[model samples]
Target: MFIEERKFEYWMNRLVSHFETVNRKIDKLSNTENKINDEVLLDNQDLCLLLKVSKRTLQRFRSSGKLPYKRIGKKTYYLESDVHEFIQNGFSKK
Candidate 1:
């Protein structure tokens, strides 16, 4: 198909513009993911290692309401801030 030069140039520019918009959106999403990761959600294993306790001991903390956690599906996650506060509040393994 014979296309006019002006129409071809316009189409190319539009395609480039659309790609740029998509790239910007991807970058924004990547930045959001990085921020979320920076917030640092700790799972059971991470907490156990940091606290130097066994999984059963950590479970005790959860059951006793000494540590705050969020359970998603079958996995538990603790916010970094909450863990810091727990330690600051003099949490001890009994």
Candidate 2:
């Protein structure tokens, strides 16, 4: 009985340590994603900021194919290259 209890306690300690390691790995991955998002934000500004247009204008542009975007699930994202190209090649000189 005594030997069985000791073995069980040792196994429980190892299991708990393994869980802690997994939690740390998850936290590290989450932090890395956040950092990447920040860098991407600098390259790709929000629709309002990039175009200096209102929400309605952005919607119109998307619908009319004036602005290209990537729709991920429910949210829309614009690439920096595409936005710049639209300004350089598509838009008429103002």
Tens-place lDDT per residue, model 1, 2-90, is 99999999999999999999999999886652113578788888888999989898788889998998887898888889899999987
lDDT tens digits, residues 2-94, model 2?
568889999999999999999999998876631224434212236587667777776777788887877666667776666787788755332
Query: Which residue pairs of candidate 2 clash?
Result: none
Estimated TM-score for each candidate: 0.57, 0.48
Off by over 4 Å in 2: 1-45, 90-94
Q: Name the lDDT of candidate 1.
A: 0.85
lDDT assessment of candidate 2: 0.67
Report RMSD (Å) for each prediction in the order shown. 6.1, 7.5
Going through the candidates in order, what is the number of backbone clashes in each?
Answer: 0, 0
lDDT of 2 at 3: 69
lDDT of 1 at 25: 96
Q: What TM-score number comes out for model 1?
A: 0.57
lDDT score of residue 84 within candidate 2: 81
